[model samples]
Target: MRRLEGTVALISGAAGGIGAATARRFAAEGAAVVLKDVADPRPQAEELTATGAQAAGVVADDADERGWAA
Candidate 1:
């Protein structure tokens, strides 16, 4: 059984670097991951999905309140 089965994780700056690594790790553990970043994270999300994870990529700026409110 996976540790994060039926769990959800929201990760910021997930388009690259540490955030991307975290996202991958979370997905591998069976968590549905939402990746938020100013840059498009669709490719990374798709990759996770291909590996049998439930994942989504959202483009937004964490520095902007409007970004999170939306």
Candidate 2:
């Protein structure tokens, strides 16, 4: 079984770079992933889901509490 089976991971800055890589890894391990980024991360999230992983994207600015609240 995968290490992250039945788990959920919240990843910030998940549109690219380290964050995107990490999101892929987590999903590979069987975790449902929530990707948050200042820009739209829906495309990446959709790709993951298409590959049979559970994933979601949310537009958020970690520096802004209002963004978090939304």
lDDT of every model, 2 decimals: 0.95, 0.95
lDDT of 1 by residue, 1-70 (tens): 9999999999999999999999999999999999989999889999999998999999999888998677
User: Candidate 2 lDDT, tens digit per residue, 1-70?
Assistant: 8999999999999999899899999999999999999988889999999999999999899998888665
Considering summed lDDT, which 10 consecutive residues are worst modelled in model 1? 61-70
Off by over 4 Å in 2: none
Clashes of each: 0, 0
